[model samples]
Target: MTPVSNGRPVTPASPGSLRRMAVTLPLVLALSACGGHVKGVMQPLDLAAEPRGNAVVDMLVATSRQPSDNPATLFSGERSALPSITDVAVSIPSGKVRAAGTVQWPKKLPPNPETDFAVVRVQPLATAQQGRDWVHRHASGGHAMVFIHGFNNTYEDSVFRFAQIVHDSGADVTPILFTWPSRAKVFDYNYDKESTNYSRTALEMTLKALVEDKNIKDITILAHSMGTWLAMESIRQMAIRDGSLPKKIENVILASPDIDVDVFSRQWSELGDRKPNFTIFVSQDDRALALSRYISGDVQRLGQINPAEEPYRTKLENAGITVVDLTKVKSTDRLNHGKFAESPQIVQLIGQRLVTGQTLTDSDIGVGDGITAIVAGTVNTVGKVAATTVATPVDLLSGNIRPLPKKKPADSGATFQSESAPLN
Candidate 1:
């Protein structure tokens, strides 16, 4: 049968493809579970009684999504002519009741503060000046972190996830969330892809404003799934517009990026010689990327590549990029596409090291030793050492690491033909 996307009929699947889909059907269902939860959970609720040790995350939200008529749902999944900025505070339950790397979604409205993550305050920032003022007030040591969420995410989904990340990671930098219009439907993949394209300029403007701000000494960008594509495109656009990116834009982390491998190579080349410290989190077991690959005419997705393999390893190393292979690090996410934020050790590495402009290496000691220690601990618990390799420009120029081996012939049969292959 032919598959339809955005109401248009597409290519029909072969019998082998049908078998593959049947095998990955469970993963698709697991991925869709989040969509089954209560919508409009963004409605702020007053806590009847203050819970001890509750952590509050204050974030500046900039979105290109149209504002919802209902106050509870601030933004709807539709494109807006202009961007909007708002300040929101989400209250996370105490450490005793909640685990790290998890968002306690409310089961119903007027959520329980002792258990569910509830909204504490929401304030609109009328102008860019107000946003600058907010940054001035919140930025710690002049450090700011911008988070761009992935596909099939609502405004509330982005907000809560960022809050959980900030609180769980204990990152001291000011948090900013840049959310685009995502219909939050499992089947609206085309719409979501186009939405990213529509909002790239807005994101570029946001990044430009932050880079120009004197108050923000350093900026770190963390983007997940399809958002990584948006992030790369925005930065690439910035480079094209202005000869180079400002030095203040320090690091960029792409988690489970959904960009085509060939496209990402082009994006990286366009960034010029001077660019942010680039780090990517990859998983060969990423079922989500598998599905994405199938939908994108069998093109390989950057996030699902086997970094240890031939061309990727040499390509990544030559580009001076750090790679963290999380194929072995188990997480609650059945799709295995969110290990960057869902794994406690990995998230801590982001806050303690990466965001601080510190490069992660197995040999590093002193202030950055936490990365090694955490990796060690994770190895003991997960029974697999998360492979982390650094190929920084400095390391390559200094000849600190050994030479890479010769490339082998590409595996012709490794595409998504296996019935055991995961979903995207």
Candidate 2:
């Protein structure tokens, strides 16, 4: 069957993808158009992360001689209480986490103790003022950047991932990671939802501490996967509570968000003219999200939201948000679920755009064969699915684009693939 790029499944392709089809997939993709319910599901039992790997070594090299603090908690892991904040010397001078456990996954990534120092877990306070006090005491300045991971992640995953972010960004920003109860064990989807709902109040409270307080100069949020929903909800409510989305809050980067696109725009409209410089990172080839499509009855997800309609596209741009398509710029991981954080190309773009606070262009960052293809397919897609590359946007940081000159294809991050999709 010749597939049209409308996101709806066309007649199944006959034994040929490109050579025999004589079909221009790009034309179909041209019409693609595309969230607001955000979320996460429990990961499988073996989803435990591997040792932090040589991540610590890289961090050491990337360090610019800085001192940090204990991370602030956005949501409590404990049902009745939040994680306690203490001076654990999150510094990785020793290069170890809890003296190493007996078990380990060869490919699994380890946690970054250094992140614990940067995004210090804020001690939850009985009042928002108390939380603000705690933040003020530990911050290097009047701003903070918080990270929240989607489903299938553990508290350990959140910390290490966040640490790498702090180290590489070269920004002296305070980091706070909010970890909801993830069961960490896959397959517990319902439980994960429960945890998400349960943590909403605490998440709101944390945001309140930042938004309600005038002392905070900057507030940034980086949420991946299911965490995007929570982040948006928090921001949406903040807008409702006040007349705007808070001027102190600068950027809100939603990477591979697991959200419903229609819902996103609706909620986004409620913010009125108060745009918060938002960014949406999407990849048509994300396998884990493909799995998400199946589990979600083929619903269009964050990574799959396509910009087909010019009205919505203009709406998004006018609202101060950029949708970066990243179905290309290969990386080292599978499933492509972690591309926004793991892929060097996308990472560089983010480090440039958000960290450095610079402007960018399409050719500056490359993706999807100079264009994007969004197809609905067997996936209950809200828009079309065109493969995209995250590298299309220029990094506001290094100010370098046009694919760094490299000799080795392996070094070029060409190994990235979708790990979650099944042939069946």
Candidate 3:
């Protein structure tokens, strides 16, 4: 009998693979407990009485999911004929009351702004012009940060997480979220993977629009897990279509990427020589990527690579990609898959350094030399005790770090087929 996963024929698993799955499946399920219970969290609340000290994150959300009929559930985890845009404001409890790098999910309906992350307002952008206007108003020094969320995420999940990141990182860029359809079920991995493929063109169009916007000077992309694949494919398509990516799109950060290692190599190679500076956050102990590796014919996943090991070390160094190895960064995240966003130090690194087009260095990381020693190795490192930051193309190992040259913008005549519209 042929093996089937999610109604699709898959290669038969080896005995060892099946044994590993038996051991890892339970942990994956336990770690994925956050999904399914929280629905309609995006429903705006009357936080008029909320205290002034609370932090509010105003984000522009673009999604390819069909709009939900319920106002609280603005978008569903299903494919849409076109992309939709909305402006959402999320309120996080003040620093005095809440810790950074944490999302305080409401224990009940009508989340209390005093403790939980709650939606304060929701507005539909009636046109692309409105989105552009929002960018102009919120963007600081023409800088924008775009976030693409990973697998098993609901619309509300993406919104709140990005809100936490923006609030914690204190990044001075306009926040935009590109959320694709994710069923938010542990067993729906295949469905979510296919959804990413389905939404690739929409993401490509969204990126092109940002590059063309006169008000946007620089853009930084942060993508996690399965979203990394989507982000890479979109950029590859853009490169193939336009000769080169716009220099304004400066930094691309991949965290816990759920991508096949071989496939990632090909994708990276296809981005052409003038690609944006790439930084990847990797952990060898990520259980999620381990499961993904098993499902993907037992091939190594990019996120679980040992950057210090052979081939990867040479390949990453040769490509001029900065790698942040987070294997020793202890986190409350049992799955060890989300250390990038869940760790306060790491998230701040994203906002304060990468978002502003600044390279990470020993002095930049407050952690002591122990962590720095690992990160300072051939592959840059950040863990519990020390942090190492590497400037691209500059060899930190050789102690020859220097500022990167200014990049000239690439000209492109590529046009996108419009697939975005305002929500009703």
CA shift of 103, model 1, Å: 0.5
Candidate 2 global CA lDDT score: 0.50
What digit string (tens of lDDT, one per residue) describes model 1 on residues 1-424? 7678999999877899888788567666766875566678777776565688888899999999999977788999999989999999999999898889988888887788989898888899999999999998997888899999999999999999999999888888989999999999888889999999999999999988898888899999999999999999998788767766778888999999999887786676456446678888888889888888877878888888776665666545555577777877777887888888887878888998888988777553223422211111111221111112321111222223332332321431111111121110
Best by TM-score: 3
Residue 313, candidate 2: Cα error in Å is 3.9
Give the local distance difference test score of model 1. Answer: 0.78
TM values, all candidates: 0.82, 0.59, 0.83
| Stronger candidate by TM-score (1 vs 3) | 3
Model 2 lDDT at residue 249: 73
Instruction: Give the RMSD in angstroms, all C-alphas superposed, for model 2.
Output: 17.4
Q: Sort by TM-score, best first.
A: 3, 1, 2
Off by over 4 Å in 2: 1-78, 81-89, 92-134, 212-215, 308-315, 355-359, 363-424
Q: What's the lDDT for all of these models?
A: 0.78, 0.50, 0.78
